[model samples]
Target: MGGYCGYLATVGGLAAGADAAYIYEEPFDIRDLQSNVKHLTEKMKTSIQRGLVLRNENCSENYTTDFIYQLYSEEGKGVFDCRKNVLGHMQQGGAPSPFDRNFGTKIAAKAMQWISKKLKEFYREGHVFANSEDSACLLGMRRRALVFQPVIQLKDETDFVHRIPKEQWWLRLRPLMKILAKYKTSYDVSDSGQLEHIRVSSPW
Candidate 1:
């Protein structure tokens, strides 16, 4: 589930009375989405038996959340009420968050320093123009620390086909989210000798 906040919306679902959240990164599969909806509807039935009501607000690619709600509505007929909440480009056109403003300022200052140093090196070498790996670099945080990575050097770490980074830092937190949300999964070996995870019903 995606939009301005992307996968963060799934994390926020906990506050909206979600028992668990299923997140799919880039290259989302329709099959997986359908499976997740089936499982979620089953869980909702269990919740209804426990005298609990649920509402959801998922964010993602345009109309993706709407599709999800529609699936729930169809599956949960006479079981629970499901509806879509449109936010109109949710949280868009607002001033940048305080943390964003501060972090951006820091990165800009560091980039300026790098540019000044590069200029000084060019002047010392008596070069009319400079073209090097350092000449074109990206300035930003890596693992909570500011880092400068040359664009040319990121080829091995870039997924050109998907137009995204191969190593996404936040993906590591997904498993933690499942754990905190009480998603109990068990692995089973298939006939083809492949292991697959089977989700167990959660009491939440």
Candidate 2:
């Protein structure tokens, strides 16, 4: 039931050891700060049972990307199947954009500075600050500047949302993503539809 938030969940899920993840983004971005790594784990292991398709056999469940795409299509009937759908608004996978790379450098530098400052303060106080919930903080970019805030101050202090907010802002589009599935292949009138078709229609 989320857009970019759903996508980033896949990203974080992949980093946390998922074989493959699908990120669906589309119009009307929304932000749901509640999703986190623990929620992801719970999603994978829950009361609902999922079919595990074996080689040379088809299952009733839709686990593949194609099936998910169908779920995204107009016929999907608002199936929040995976709470994952629609990636028209998702970032294309590739090398980092120059802006993102540069932003990363700045963010890393700021975080390092914060860490160093905290270490110095700890040394002065003769105490080690290792994973203290009260001392824990989230680093982010705001107004083009890196800022640090204590985790206690945020309703969500999860590692995912606290550090990266891209998906959060796009969460609202999750519903539209499912609906986009209807328009997926209905419009292919462009000369560049050959490549653009795949690019726009499929969220892969």
Candidate 3:
């Protein structure tokens, strides 16, 4: 869940009743694999101690669930039961919520309207509609409004290497989400002068 629209996916995980959601906001590096696994396992230890179900969303392109599951299991000393469910070829497939259904309908309606207008103008001009920002735009909801953005501009804003948008609006909600989930993150300096994160139980 830490790739592409990971923030939104993290929200969906929370909505699905996960006790805690771990979102990977940064890109995964092979050099940091060991440290990353240790870090995640340490975080999961806190959730396990509190008897909470945890869900981690990471970029599949960088690492697979197997890597995390296997490493986490080894770190857990066979005490924690780790399970993995693979939904092949399903893009978050499940029963659509009312809000999602409504949003889809609205988007479709608006898209058809826009296409119809373009078709009418094209016929009126008796010439092919040139590919421009107006002709090639993505209609999406941004901040509760249906905004259209040029594909060219979006391409420029994309992290081509990662194949995700460079700027994600939902990232701002990461801290708030963690706070609401009762995830208290505390930091401390070890004897080796290394920084370490220690999870503290939330009062609320």
Candidate 4:
């Protein structure tokens, strides 16, 4: 948990809460950073206002668009009407990419394999083996196999760190997305839309 927290902070910044939100939302690895930047930049260029609003709303659970609105409004930033620009249901109507399908399959397979192994281990340990007559024991077995029971479930121990705030994370990485767009990095849809290169020429 300590290690995971540090990794989250290093990857997504402190704005990501201690929860597993970083796994789904924040860029935790170099590959993730590159992929995320490419996706975000493309979205921004196609629809800057909409993209920015989505990012603001979903960047972190703790730091919301409302929080930003209040903070900036106090400093004379005018009210932003998100309703007009919101895509709403349109965002959910996209086909799943090959990457999504492949990754989902892989995770499902791994989870099933883990569950099988855990059940075997539990049986070998000679824990009270209730027969088919015992539905409660069967349910307990399922729970033990499928549930993620951490060795230490303390409140202070989280799977995310607090190195950079969420807002700062967005500020720093958003430019990288713009740079990728400006350079026209290849985005092959079939190949999981990976960025082919991010070449930076030295000014020397």
Off by over 4 Å in 3: 1-5, 16-24, 27-64, 88-91, 186-204
Candidate 3 on 43-141: residue-level lDDT in tens?
555744422333344454446668656755675564455566654446566899999899999999999998888777666456766555688889998
Worst 10 residues of 2 by lDDT: 51-60
Clashing pairs in 4: 5-160, 5-161, 14-164, 15-166
Q: How many backbone clashes does every candidate have?
A: 3, 14, 2, 4
Per-residue CA lDDT of candidate 4, range 1-204, in tens?
212122322233333211112322333444543443344444444544332322223344554446534432443224222232333355454788997797667657766775576666557466734333221211211222434333233223433354222322222333343343333342222243334445454222
| Candidate maximizing lDDT | 3
Q: Which scores better on TM-score, 3 or 4?
A: 3
For each candidate, the alpha-carbon lDDT, in order, equals: 0.57, 0.42, 0.59, 0.37
TM-score of 4: 0.33
- Model 1: per-residue Cα lDDT over 39-89, one tens digit each: 555656564432121222332344365566676678667766665565556
Model 2, 66-137: lDDT tens digits are: 653443343323322334334443536678889989988988888888888778766646677565564588
Q: How far is 136's C-alpha from truth in model 1 (Å)? A: 0.2
Candidate 2 error regions (>4 Å):
1-4, 8-94, 125-134, 142-144, 155-167, 172-204
Worst 10 residues of 4 by lDDT: 134-143
